[model samples]
Target chain A: MQKDSFRVRAADLLDIPADIKGGLLHIEITGKREVFIENHKGILELSENEVTLNAGKETVRVLGQRLRVLAMNNNEIRLSGIIESVGFVREGSSCSQL
Target chain B: MQSAVNFVRGSVLLEVKSSYPERFFNLCARHGIEFWDMTNDGLGVFRIRMTVKNFKRIRPVARKAMCRVHIVKRCGLPFFLNRFRKRAALISGCAVFCIIAWIFTSFVWVIDIDGYAELDTARLLNELSKQGLRVGTYAPSVEMENLKNNILIDMPELSYISVNINGSHAHVTARKRTLPPEILPSELPCDIISDKDGIIHDITVKSGTPEVVRGETVTRGQILASGYVTGRAGTTITTHADAEIRARVWRKKSARMPKKYSEKVYTGREKDLYTILLFDNRIKLYINSGISYTKCDKIIKRTDLRLFGRYRLPISLERATCREYEISKASVSDETAYDSLSKGLMSSLELPEDAEVINADFITSSDEVFAYATLTAESIEPIGTKREILRNG
Candidate 1:
């Protein structure tokens, strides 16, 4: 209830409050893949069949895809297997173009 | 909770009272502690639990509220051990007294065998001696549990054996094993007959053969029974209706207060105690401390016994009793007299509901200070019919 220090991270699904001041983000690897990070910032959500990300704008979705968000500072996301791919997008990536 | 149990634990509990419960709760919250049993007894007596740990912290608060902060007067072994001023002389005196008392108590001064039915005194004592429970034996050395077990083992006949020590004596009470006294040793050739005037409910022949079957009509003494009837075989006899019956019987007793039976009441106080040596009245262990008030009556019983049957010494047991005082002359109307009579009758005769009180007699003259009544009750019991058969028959 107190706005004092709270953090939440999730795998397989990302249900973030869209109106949280800094907005929300999610990244994925195409092989049900693995994402390694040197450092990270926001959250990276991983799941089978799809990769979705929210970076202050629209959600990025890539199905039959493997992807990784690079240098996101202190936070990490990973998914590994099938099609084995990776990617990152800024504000306004289309969910319909997966 | 009672803290005055005189237990070995050093912990003392207090039942403190405080009006401002909120303040009390805040105090406990401020300090890492809690108060249980939060109850308000009228104005001031608020019952709350407190440990010895926080007594110092709350003492000032208790004083401020004039709260009766009772650390529930702990008479614990530690408190008693710590309470009194440390004096070497007193301690030594107590030690010496304890040693003397220890010695005194160590020696079994009196012994009584209670609850004896068939067990002989000599047999019990002999059995008790085997269990290290004889008179003049060291009380401190006597392991009561071990002694009980040992006695039980030695006399397997005793149902229960308890050894209790009060003051300087050991009370050895045991229940003697009782079975139906040697049952008429093998039933003689006897007969089954109606015990009551009513039709027999059922008949069972344990040893003898039966003659009366179920649903057989029979009268009292008109034996639907037989012992010497001719059987199917020429010389053989029919089922003998004989019974050397065993029955449980009890007797009811009735006694009227025939002549103002005496009643006793303890005045709650009695004196005249002297240190008597080994139950010997003549051999006083200590001189009687001078005091007044000797209108009381006391009953003293003495028993002498030896240690391991080596040397015997009598144990003096004095049951001091206050003398029963006689009533003074009272103004009485007819109603009060009748009430007194009824009370007296109720006390004397405890009758059953079916029992009819056929008579209530007042047997007192004008000169008599007390009045009494006699009650006659009617009851029923089966009278046994024993025919002393002539040997010729």
Candidate 2:
């Protein structure tokens, strides 16, 4: 047995987050086209930075220059970083200005 | 991974300066508070991780006058999180070790027979096999005590037995039991008899009646004289003699010298070399080549497995080899045949010193594998001494 050398990266108990349930998690970027994902699973697929999620009976697309979904669930979703705003792109609906 | 609590699991006493320390101590004891340093040292503090469930009860005790209730930063969540992984890891590690230990202990790969004497080794092994301590047996399944008892019972001459297992080796030690001495106990009075018939040289009587006289030629078992003395002219005669006569007897031995035996025999000259093996390859098996000459009977063989535990199963190797042999024996010459005849006669003939070789008449001679001949010698030797027993009414 050797000593563990993994440095503890402390975070505020409240700041640490979780989504205990299964769902699609995405990080999107408007200007950046390339995204890297080390691991993915389920009915999930991705290309570029945009993420299309059909979960909880909702087709949601969060468009931004850079975005990340830290965790997600059927009832609640956790997001991080600043966002410009949120809008939906439906089959019949188009992107509208706020 | 080990628990932090265990290293610090021993007690560190705590003494309190708070008013009514006795009450607090009692209350703590009542509430089963299991922490702290005991000696009083200016409002002693105890750091402990109490569950949220029990935290409420302690709140009232700490909230009393001159008491301040504060929950120090507890590191419980991560401790348990790490614990679940660590204990599982430890148990699984131990499980794997136990399996390997069991596997090594299960088989009796090497069997050792620790004791035996002039008893036949092969026969002992065959007997041991009947008792189930053979070479290729599994140790765990062997009932050693039962096996030992069975062996002792079956072979009464084996006094003690011990069976021990070390790793894959099963060792059996035994002691041979010796039988008691034999005695011929029946008392039947058969007349004393001489082993050989000879001319009477001397005689003495001890008991019973003597049946032969001095200067008489006595056949085998003929008593030479009487131990019972007859009283003459009012003299009382004793029925015993102090000593027996000594005699010298002639003994002879004769054997025909063989030119050669009909059966073929192996020559003492032999050679053998072995191959070395490691794993499956022959690295260096033997340190030296034994001998070079092979006679009529030759044997050549190689076996890698049985003697080496890892390479081969428990069976030895044997192989017959080809040999170059002489086609025929040269016919013995007359002079050579006579010399061989004398050599053979001298070796085989045994006679008393007084005995003489009146003549060595060679009957016949033949030379094939060897010259064969026979000899006849005559000799003189002394014989006949008797100790006779006499019966008195």
Candidate 3:
């Protein structure tokens, strides 16, 4: 935890993206239709209505209707189809809220 | 666009039935197996598309995930070609057709000649054939500059020539040499002579002395205007004679038509013969039985097969239509024969456009086998013609 905090502070002080320095997931959402996640760990759970992914420190859950994995590779996961909301569940946190 | 890439690379659609499908997805992602269009069917069944190479690598992933992967559909070029592997004849036919098409397109099929006026097309084509530029000649072997030069040297009448070969068609354009106009000696002493025996009605001499006055009778070859002109000092100077002499000319023309004539009467009976032309060889499609009609007309229509309405193919279809007819004797009425003969005689007269006809009389006569009409007419027309005066050196 100390090492992660020092890395975040260094990234902020040096004006660098934390995702690049701290290995954080970089998620980009486009108009509630598509969500592209870079620096992903793997898919945790997948279904038609929702998708959950392991993003190193947090579990990212995508809630949508007829959600699908458009494309997936080691570092990237692209989800499409009527995305409703995205909530992040940190370690030991309940799945109720972000 | 990605689908096109997948199709070219050969992809397979797989249906995964597993208790834990998310593990299968994560295993595929961890193994760097790119997949797309993933969907869930709600009964623990999911569908996804992956490349053929990745599908081969998915056996370990499927085993690790405890998933049974079934190929729902196989798509792309390899699968499509494998489906036709059993039909050997069809594949060979397609191969042969492509080979034949390639071979046919390598040679010239059509030769288009343009810009030819007064020059005979057949003669030009014959000349071109002699120089190895005719139809069916290999297009790449044609040396255009040498061919043009050879043809120009062989036929001096062609001033400019260009040969352009586009695919199986060769377009040859040529311009004919324009001959210079004839140069006449205007300084030569000449006389205006009467070309026909006529009574002089008017005479206008431009550069010579008038030899005949109005109402004077002149015969053919008689000089109407003399080339010798008396100058103001009474000195005789020879000059070219130019004059327009209008005179009353008499002409007679006669035409005869046979009273009995043979006319062609169609019997309404016809027969069709078909032929197939493959390149230069003609194959008769119809059986060769002797023609039944004694007198018939054979009309042949040839249709050339083409590709895309532009590329001419060597194969063609020919249909010969034979129409039977019989000859029947027919006689013309006296009045009809007289009218026909009179029209023929008038057309045969070959009167000038500006001539004015003063009087005309037609005499009709009939013989045992023929009817005749004679036309006698008097017209006022220009009768002067130039005749050069030959002087001894």
Candidate 4:
């Protein structure tokens, strides 16, 4: 808890955004047609209905229909199709919170 | 945009079959090897497009990920060059053709003369050649202004001339000089006689003696004024006769206007013929041969290509349209004939400005008609005749 408080204070002091300071993955959705994820580690599970990505400390699960992995590199990955919802799951935390 | 760049540099599509294809992407990114357009086949195979430079680097990453990589397709200029590397003659021929085209365009290949009907084309072309404006000559070497002046000095018959160079063609336009009416000098002894039979109305003698008076009838060739002015003491002064005599003259002019006349009427039917003109030779491409028109008039239109709106090409396309016409008999009333005859007679008459038409009498026959018109005119015309005296009159 103290380390977490120190990290938050250091983030405020350094004038860095939360997503950048924590090395969190940034997800951008354009009108539910496309989704872009930056700073992703790798794909944990991929399918037409659901795509789960390792984004730093959390797992980003994307639920959609006919979801396609349009393009990908180390920095970012672009997903296209009907995106219904995006849920984040922390380690030892239930996935239903997000 | 990225795909277009990659296509030019040459790229390949790879099909990677693995349980975890995402690991291959992460490995490629870690090695700074960029790839895009990734697709998951949902059956443990993923298709991705990557540049040729990075394709070899991806093998190690695919091996580490335990994914089997296979080239699905290869594209771009590198592939094209490899496929056509054996056709040496075709490549050289294309190069030679391009070089020849460029060289030919630098010189004038065609000389076209427009608006020159009365002037001789051969003579104009010879003069143009002397002035460095001719076919097969360098287009930029011809000085247009200097050539224009030189041509005008050499050919006084041409009033205006313009030289235009369009691509591989040279266009020359010129206008002919119109000469003034001929006049005879009054140095020789001459006679002024009546041209037609008339009743003398007035006479004005400038250097001659008056012969006829008003109300006096004069026939054709009758002298209205005398050139010999007899001075005092019987010594006659032979002079160039000058006089103005106005007379009321009558003339009969007739035109046969049949009640029914055969005329050529346009039927609005036409046939077209197309031809290609290369240099001076013409090759007919399409023509209608079955046309049977009793009378037809043909109109021809020739078009040549102009490059950059300034240069003209030697090649031309010609289209000839033949409009068909037929002879048909038509009838008209006497009143219509009279109106037509009046207009026709008026146009044919060379009457003076102040002349007055007194009366017109028309005599219409079954197949012919005659018109007798009496006119009065005020004229300043010489009517005196001079005959050389043979030492005794």
Off by over 4 Å in 1: A1-98, B1-123, B126-133, B137-175, B181-189, B193-271, B276-295, B299-393
lDDT of 1 by residue, B1-393 (tens): 344431544444555555543344334434544343344343434454444455557765555545556666553466667755677788889889988866775677667777775777788878777877666677777888887887778777888988886645667788877666543223233344554333233455543445555544444564434344455675744333444322222222333222334444445565545444444345544465443544446555444445567444464434333343443334554445555655655566544344334334444333244433433332232222332222355
Off by over 4 Å in 3: A1-27, A56-59, A87-98, B112-119, B159-167, B171-253, B268-278, B282-294, B306-312, B317-324, B342-365, B374-393
Write down the C-alpha DockQ for each prediction: 0.02, 0.01, 0.71, 0.35
Poorest stretch of ten by lDDT in candidate 3 chain B: B179-188
**Model number with the top lDDT:** 3
Using DockQ, give the best candidate's number.
Answer: 3
lDDT of 2: 0.48
Weakest 10 consecutive residues of candidate 4 chain B by summed lDDT:
B373-382
Binned by DockQ into CAPRI classes (incorrect, acceptable, medium, high), candidate 2 is incorrect
Better of 1 and 2 by TM-score: 2
All candidates' lDDT scores?
A: 0.48, 0.48, 0.89, 0.77
Error of 4 at A55 (Å): 3.4
Which tens-of-lDDT digit does each residue in B185-283 have in candidate 2?
223233444545555455664554556556566566554444445565866454433334333343343333445334444443444444443323444
